[model samples]
Target: MLPFYSLLLIATWLVPKYCLVQLNEPFLYISATTFKFVLTSTLFLTKLKMKMSKFVCFITKKLQNLSIFVNPFWIQICYFISVSSVGFLVLKVLKPRNKSFRPNDFDVFFMSVSATTVSSMSTLEMEVFSDTQLTVLTILMVLGGEVFVSVLGLHWLNSKFKKQETQNKVIDPLVVSVEDLRYKSSIRYLSYVVWAYFLVIHIVGSTMISIYMSLVSSARNVLKNKGLHLVTFSMFTTVSTFTNCGFIPTNENMIVFSKHSGLLLILIPQILLGNTLYPPCLRFLIWVLWRLTKREELNYLLRMNFSDGIGYNHLLPFLHSCLLVVTVFGFIVIQFILFCCMEWNSEALKGLNCYQKLVAALFQSVNSRHTGESVVDLSIISPAILVLYVVMMYLPPYTTFLPRKNDEQSLRSNEKMKKRREKLVENLLFSQLSYLAIFIILICITEREKLREDPLNFTVLNIVIEVISAYGNVGFTTGYSCERQLKHDGYCKDAWYGFSGRWSNEGKLILILVMFFGRLKKFNMEGGKGWKLM
Candidate 1:
């Protein structure tokens, strides 16, 4: 913790000093804040690449000797790069790919981060990133809600290019066929269908919330400046939860006129947004049952699946998604209750209105799985709430978005051919489950004393929490940023010394990692062998 703060402070001072020194070179000159920002971004990208570098090289070498062109690691890397870039591209271009398809891992990762982080929470737009950058990112995130669909579109482009006799063919041949194309296309369409449920409910709810806030108690005076604030707020939130950025432009000190409008609009959308994203568990359930029952209809739908992948044909996706939903919401509800009963419960509601409190709870749950929106003052937030966040931060995405092959010989099953197939599946599944639990427990036990002492120590618990936070792209904090305020006088003084957001060097790095991890496929984090999600 001490090192963390010290490094941050040093960066704050050093970057500006360096920038000032470089000022004579007009082309190279930039603000200290911007320079620090780039430096932080570089640190994050470097670390992320380093984290996967070894694993990727190992997989590549193994595949090289065996003639598996375009190894799984390449797919994963491509998935990350594509998901991020394509989503930005599509929003502007209005390309051919629709929502019904499931994309490869890169596209999926893009969609996952786009959807989960809810980039709509971002206030910056044509004003901040240039009209093109804003428009591209927004559209990609808004329309491209699922990583799977993006993967589909990218693969299709590659396929068409391949046929056109392009130079490179990165996606393996198995992923190149028309059958795969149709299946994936169908999946993306279904995602839009899923969006329909979220859209309508979101529109109706957000509209009502906006109207209420616009006309409600103590709103008229303060809200006079930004009349369309409510409408834009609603739409942005729709984009946010739909995408999951959880960024709120208005908070306690700012946007008084739009206070309730901001909170209600921001929080409510996530409740439905989390449900709209990929339905991995549902697909999984369908996969297992489809295998055992040999149901003709189920098989046909999957065969005629509307998109690139067979996502809707199985119940596994639905089940897994339900688990994810429960895991996130369950933790939030439990924490909310615990907070309500705590001694400082009243303090939790210190200056917030009812809508704000509701928004805070919902935001907490939603961020548990995706992007974090820490609207409530963290200083007042009890340790219990932080614990809940830590717990959610460590829990893997309840649903494994990767396509599982339950065929005669899965990576897990082939090893135990001597054993019954069912026995092998059970053994592998349980063993991994056991491994996860033990590994987590060991990390906790090893770091328990540190956690107790500082609770904010960056140990295994912090690493685990960081990983999970990265998984959903939800940014969690002990008392980081504007999410909480100056209960500790020193922190308040630190704020006046410089802009908190500008000063946040390490925080920026953590955010980039979270954003990258935020887009990573759920199962990939679990260490499944020979299973390239893309």
Candidate 2:
């Protein structure tokens, strides 16, 4: 048992290091291979079997005792906070690209939280970050992404099931129910599917982006001029887009590459696959598996129940999944039409030709939903379009247009609805809007001077948009401009950052909490139901 435990710890440390290193690093490969060989050799030692069994039982009993406090919501919150803290420390130690620029401690911490939550809210320019800082951000975004987090959750569930099975085997094998077995099998299958989805999209997306940048001299030159490596830019953009984080390597975001319609086209699918279109895509994948393998577990996974037969919420019914696809596209089309009509002759699209404008409009429309990657200055866009973008950002990623069920189906679902309502605690008294209003008010107080002096730039509408964007975990903002200030002072200087970058320390702190709240908003989806106005 001692030998096995020691080897397990060593393996865990070596495996992660090995994975992070390049293939050209043969020393790590040899170390990993040697560790694996030694671990396997020790596993076959018959003398340790009895001790190992005893240790397993001891650990299982301890875990069972401690399981009462293991809430998934708290686990997720802690995960984000822990990752953010680590990122902050790493960024603090790493030197910035610009030797003269030294960001405030609060801003560095804010950037860490923003990246960890995939919110993309910035208080500093993107180019100021060294390549190491960018890599750290890339890692944070990938780890914080919805798809990657879901995969981690699936892995946790699978391990929990395995532990339960082990305990049942040791205590009473017959206690394991048929339903439990089916559920466990389904979780394992879903875990595999999610992992495949995450890996395949990243691999394909990065590869395509790399190839496009190579062929397109204009795109390649943008990175070269900025002193960015082609591979780093490709991987960073791919991760950011797929995660819907919107934190591009360049300060201007997608605006710098607005003319690269091909690049925008390449990213559109990646954005959808990672966010709004995920549920439908997952359902389709399971359906395809059901078709190929004709497996009962996959079929059970595709069930129309809200619980999805396996306790996974994302796997929607066939009808609901189809409706979600239509609803998402419908929103995109509406945004595209309005943006094109309003901004067609505006300065935002002035330099671009008609085709470029169309592609840029489509890209902006898609990003307005959650990605937050913009092709044009959002501040310069029409107020009407900005309002539309705000609404789009406020809506949840899985917002779908589900048709009313027939009488019989409605009757059948009533019991489930009642059960769900019964689980909602009265303590969750505030709605999502209520929280947003409170944040907006706090921000206004913090930025009260700015609001008064620069009414045009710091209008209530702009404040509302910024607050909603933070609460929605979308990074869209009516960015600050010294030009828009009513009375321009010598102190007023424009910085290449988001609107929130111009916010005071107190306001920035408030938005940091908003980003955290938004990231964990799934846990409180039914919150504020107890305080319904109706």
Q: What is the C-alpha local distance difference test score of each model? A: 0.43, 0.81
Instruction: Supply every candidate's count of residue pairs whose N, Cα or C atoms clash at under 3 angstroms.
Output: 65, 0
Give a tens-digit lDDT track for model 2, residues 1-534: 767667685775578356547455655554554444334333432333345335434544544444568766766787789889999999999999997889999999999999989899999899999998998898889878988677655655666787778999999989999988887898788877876777667767877787677667799799999999755687788889999998999988888999999999999999999999999999889889889999988887876476333556676677777888999999999999999999999989989998999999999999988889988998888999999988999899988766646432344344545665444543445778888889888999999998888898888998898888887878987788998878877898887788988888999999999999999887766556567465
lDDT of 2 at 401: 66
lDDT of 2: 0.81
What residue runs in model 2 are displaced by over 4 Å at the alpha carbon?
A: 1-67, 404-424, 532-534
> TM-scores of all models?
0.50, 0.84
Task: State in Å the error of residue 165, model 2.
Answer: 0.8
Assess the local accuracy of residue 460 in candidate 2 as a C-alpha lDDT between 0 and 100: 94
State, as a TM-score between 0 and 1, how close model 1 is to the true structure. 0.50
Error of 1 at 47 (Å): 38
User: Candidate 2, clashing residue pairs?
Assistant: none
| RMSD (CA, Å), each prediction | 16.9, 8.7
